[model samples]
Target: MSLRRWGAVLAGAALVAGAAVTPALAADPVAPKVTVAPATGLDPAGTKIVVKGTGFDPAANDGKGFGLRVGPAKADVRDRAGKDFQVSRLIKKGAVGSQIPLDDNGNWEYSVTVKAEYVASGTTYSAKKQPFSVFVFGWDTPVLTWDSTTPLKFTEAGDAATGLAWGLRHSWRNYVTRGGGTVTPSNGATLDTAAPNVEPYPYKWKYESSGEGTVSYTGQVTYTFEAHTIWDFTIADPRITFGGDGAGTLTAKVGYAFYGTKTAPEKVRTPSDVVLADLKLKAPAQAGDNVAVDIESAKLTAAGAAAFADFYKPGEALDTGRLVFPGKSGPAPTSSTVPTSSAPPTTTTSSSAPCVLTPDSVKQGNLLWGFKQSFRRYVGIGSGTSITASDGVEITDIDKIDGTGPPSGAYLWGFDSVQYKSATEFTTQFRGKVTFAYPAHSFELSIGRPKVVVAQGKGKLFADVELKTTSGAPSPPISQPGVELASLDLAAAKTTEGAGALSVAGIKVTLGNAEAFAKFYKVGEVLDEATVSLGASCAHLPGPGASGPGAGPGVSDDLVPDVKYRPDSALASTGADSGMWLLWGLVLVGAGLALVLVVRRRPAPGQRP
Candidate 1:
């Protein structure tokens, strides 16, 4: 019944030495003094409860410090009323002196006796006992944080927010490496499971004393693990590839949150709650691999808060969750549905017309071709001159086609050469006419290189004006010369044959007259160098940079639509094809079986059965 009696039996059985050495049956010495201190007094869950005692002999030499024998080291406060608490593990023992602390936990009063044997004049005497009462408070509230530098707190409820209240102990899962420990604080206060209405943690504070009887709660408490903004914002899925000289890296911020604790306290006091900012991701090349990041909790400054918002949504701060860093080419949800004004217009009409269909000639002077100079080359003049009765002499239906038109050196319809000579032939001066004459009206149009209109002479005769290329190049050639009435009536030019609608080439006129001075106009078009301007904040960050021939490495083939053939496979093909093939196979087998049956059933004329 007594621990000293139990210790003597244990020592005798545990040690090979006989009863003469066993420290039992000796007279009781002095009662050992015991003192206990809870590891975390505020919220003791896995917190230590150290029991310090003295009067045990330092050396009758067994073990120095002692472990918990009958009581539980961990308290379970899941059921506070019934007080269902159990001890979890024994603390490691160290050398014990006059004051040795035994680490254990429980609110109940228990006794721990340290034993030591002393031989006095060939006789042995038993040491004294050390007893203590453990008063563990506030072990019901669980702290579900991982190894982080800052403490994870809850969002404090204010006058506008709902007041804090305890609920039924909910079953919650904490993610950690198996055998990685977690501390539960509820059970430490009281293991009274039957008393469901009882407060898990005694509301010893004066603030909650008024609403004592009204608190009705039940159910298992669940706590989900989430990462913080610090770890979440850390870049992942970094992609690097060669540009001209250095490699470009593309990455986007990513994260997740679990719905357990809807709100938590903030360790750092700030003007606003920690939130995530929408991220401006930049990279030179396509990132093939996913970036791994760990988000930790931290306080944000004014600038940091703005930056965080760019990466995360409002109220959804980065919590403890594994995120696959978004790649440059990954599909992401549209952040905002409202389109921006600066957003490129899907269908744009330019103020100044692109290469126009005309019957008149371009007479811009001294054009330069393929020069390493300006951004755009000179396209031909708007020659598709329609003289409306209301808008006489005014070229009708000619306006700028913004963000669209013939790709470099392409004519008005993106087909046929705009240049009179080959791309390699370079000339300095030339006169070409893009003349479109109606039965009653005539328009003379001229275009010079880079993009210059030397003259657009139009009366009942010609559009007499000067034209110049955007780069002030020598005159480009005049193309597509024919009577407007005759060319518009051609059936071959207005036919739509295949999958897509009729293309620009479907409508065409004769490139009748094209003349360029061999020396003045340069041949062999050069890809112009484009200068892109970016905004201040987004300047250093990767803006819409030019990509090489293909998307960067690790580019998935699935994204690029297979335009080669069988494009209507989703609609054209179906289960019917497979079913038809199966039906044919089944019919063939049936025919073969029928033949076999016929052969077996055939009668023999010469022989009797």
Candidate 2:
């Protein structure tokens, strides 16, 4: 009977057999089902609008959720706009809002976006008119009317109002929207899309007058603009290669001019005359060729204005005709040539002349005759050497004597002293007399005479001597004063040795002073067992007793009278050297006895002999 209460319960139950009590079954809400994703668009401000709500009511509203309202379309009624177009709060499914802005007024239609509601416990579920669209944030200007039964026509009556303001400023700067600014157009209307890759004439917005107003043509009055896809149209400065049949055509006539109010009949613009009618361009067959285009541009036609007057006659004249297009002339650029080869006719042989050492053939009076020398100075081993001027040395006063240009030959002589005859080494054999003072000892000698540069050529006689002294006396542990000497190819004579004699085993001495002594010589030192010779002599001695030819009072009648060793009948017909033609006939008889002793001792040019 622990079920004591159970006993009572049974009694009560029996008594209440008439129990009709059964009430607790609620699950009937779910009225959500909302949706919005894009659906249409243009610029609903920030526009994100998601809203999705499927059978909502997860524990009804007590859970505090569901209720996304995105304005307008009667706010999706649920107790007459509860929470008035709420903006977002739906949670049993979805609700993304982006703040639901909306206001661009340039109205291109379609508006309403997601006005969902969900409520729950108290019951309410809505979502109607979720369309979309905002548009109008920039260029959309469209009012352009003019098309009265093909009325506007002006062949050229002074260019009918400048071709109706140049076809309405190039059709509103090429179909409007230059948002980044700049669009100028006037009588001469230009704006061919500023060139570069061109392409911009496909416009729209139709309806011309009959349905009453709206025009932006490129579709009629002869429209035609196929600039061959204009690849950066440059005309000159060397860039003239345009062919693929470049084209053009833009005629215009359009009519109607009323201006609002004739019971609403607006349609304006009736002026006319916009041509560019027949421009052709396809000319490059040579001036840099590259063709292609059998025909297109709707099969072209207008070959009018004499085809643009020979289309710029061979093209090249664009100081601003601003694109007239019509080129076609071709052929006239042929110049290639580059073959060259002709150089095999030289020859050149003539040799001879040149063994000349002249100063009037080695002068005489005061003696000059240089070449004919012999040297040997070393003072040892063979008993202090000996062999000074083995028959050479005579130069006493020969002044400027120069020569060159005789089949590779040169000689320059200037002297003032040379008596020579030294020998000391403690009197190895005793000898005295010695002058040698050229320019007081800074001597110089250069000779290279030996001609016949070709025909059996074999000539070479060289020498370059130098000697300096600050006060003479050198030959001991020599010290700096100078002493160069060379003899390179010294002797090879025989261009038929006319002037003959010269053989010291074909000379080749070389020993240009290496710092003068340097402890007894070492720089290119080559004595080669000493023994040298060079010839050619002359002597008359007796001339410095001055009396005329300005030999006195600071003399210098420009010191004339050398006549550069005269005698050159073309250098004596190329074989020269008959002793230089007997010293050129004794230097023309000593220049005719010194011009007859200066004209019997000048007393002319204002006297004074």
Provide TM-scores for the models: 0.14, 0.13
Clash count per candidate: 129, 7
Best by lDDT: 2
lDDT for every model?
Answer: 0.21, 0.22
Which residue window of length 10 is worst by lDDT in model 1?
A: 344-353
TM-score of candidate 1 relative to the true fold: 0.14
Worst 10 residues of 2 by lDDT: 423-432
Candidate 1 lDDT, 1-609, residue by residue in tens: 887878767787867655445554666654434354321111111112334444433321132222222122213222122121122111212211111123332112222211122222243322212111232221122321110111111111110111112111111111211223222322111121211112122111001111111111111111222433221112111111112111111122222222234354322123222222222222222223222121122122244345333332233322121112222222221222111122111110001111211222111111111111111111222222221111111111112122322222211110112221211111112222222221111222332212211111110101122222222122333342221111111232222111111111121121111132212212222211111111111011110111211222111111111112111333112112111111000112533321111011222443211
Best by TM-score: 1
Pairs of residues clashing in candidate 2: 209-212, 209-213, 371-534, 371-535, 372-534, 372-535, 373-534
Instruction: Give the TM-score (vs. native) of candidate 2.
Output: 0.13
